[model samples]
Target: MSLILKDLTVSAGKRPLLEIPELVLPAAGFVGIIGPNGAGKSTLLKALAGVVSHGGTKTLDGAWPDAGRIAFLPQDFTVSAAMSVADCVLLGRREHLGWRVTGHDRAEVRRVLSMLDLTPLSDARMDRLSGGQQQRVLLAQRLLRDPRLLILDEPTSALDLHHQLEVLSLLKTLSGGMLVIAALHDLTLAGRFAEQLVLIEGGRVHATDSPERILTGGTLDPVYAIRCEVFRDRDSNPVVVAHPAQGARAGSLER
Candidate 1:
């Protein structure tokens, strides 16, 4: 489903954390939000998911089929110590059940657990899982809803390189008819997986375009405060190589 953010602003206590004049998220495929720390990337996602209060309109297209609607996975995921993995994932079906979970809901929970490679951990307590495994389990919970719009905040933070690729690949495969928006810190992985990229800085949208178009040195250098070299791979897609900021040149010796 398409998401339109018009004049969105978010405040935390006395400070404004996010301010977006306008943004249009595509109806399908993966979109990456990239920026430095405290750039309001996570805040943007939370605002769009209606988990936080913000000023502005976030509209999902009416023409688009709203099957399961929206699901959000935050960066810091926490579950009660007593809840099992299966039970946590089963919570995603709560909206459909209205009051109580049924046999059908349990079946869906099983399906999502298997789909996310969590079948083996179904009976395990969520507090006992590793960080990466916990992340996947939470994703499984979100997937149980079969949402049309999936918003994830820093989904790869706790994953190793191998698991990171695996999660991102799974996300790509799952984006066939859904919109997947993630706040990602790894620029290279973001470029590889995301069809489009949105760069934010100082609570403002600096640029939004295809990864090949927005990950360029000209756009990233100032925003990130680092020198970056942009090059093309064998496929002619953009690859960014970052370096430290340039230092002042040494004084020249007298002739």
Candidate 2:
């Protein structure tokens, strides 16, 4: 069930944004894509999600995936629709839904709402929810799709510390049954959850390996142009601490 990408390329106008000669991602595991701010992490994720035009061959087990089996959640999780939470989440199952709504679909929606702790807000309007709340709701929708390959862009960007940990923990649990790839800025959290990490820079794959190997000063310092120190938390997860590079002038490390 692994996903394999070959000769993947994404371009805008005449300039290329991402290019992957070859990449193999294991099935039922979590992968973190990390690099500098302008790196192609988002572009790579978007290409796999089919959100952007790309030239490549993405296959699951050497064949195209079945419909409704691949779900994507981009960084922009805003919802201006006037639909209720329950109604909006149910849309995830649209590909399999019938002309008439069924009890089965409603039941699954309720299950996902409770999974993301959004049951209390089930009756609320999508437009009235906060940014973090909308992110969770849309994520629940993607989960309801029951995808085999899940692509997420900066999934934890809009949440508080509590929800960020909660969501990452939940995604780790889901990775046991589906492939989950996310672009993350939090290196410590990424090390804690991702089985492997992919470092992208200048529209190409710079390196791909275990989190321990990729989240190091040797890898990040040159790519980010900043001094980085990798430590370990109580759980032994790598903690990344960044500082101004040795020769960096004051206020030059504003990223």
lDDT to native, each model: 0.84, 0.88
Model 1, residue 254: C-alpha shift (Å): 36
**Model 1 Cα lDDT, one tens digit per residue, 1-255:** 477888999998989899888898888889999999988898898887878999977776745334357889999986647689999888777767767777888888988888777789999998888888889989998888888899999998999888898889999989887889999988888998999999999999999999977887677878888877776666666667777766823221111
Clash list (residue pairs), candidate 1: none
Q: List the residue pairs that clash in candidate 2.
A: none
Please report how far candidate 1 places residue 67 from its true position, in Å: 12
> Per-residue lDDT for 183-236 in model 2, tens only?
998888888889999999898889999988887877888788887778788887
Q: What TM-score does prediction 2 earn?
A: 0.94
| Per-residue lDDT value at 186 in model 1 | 85
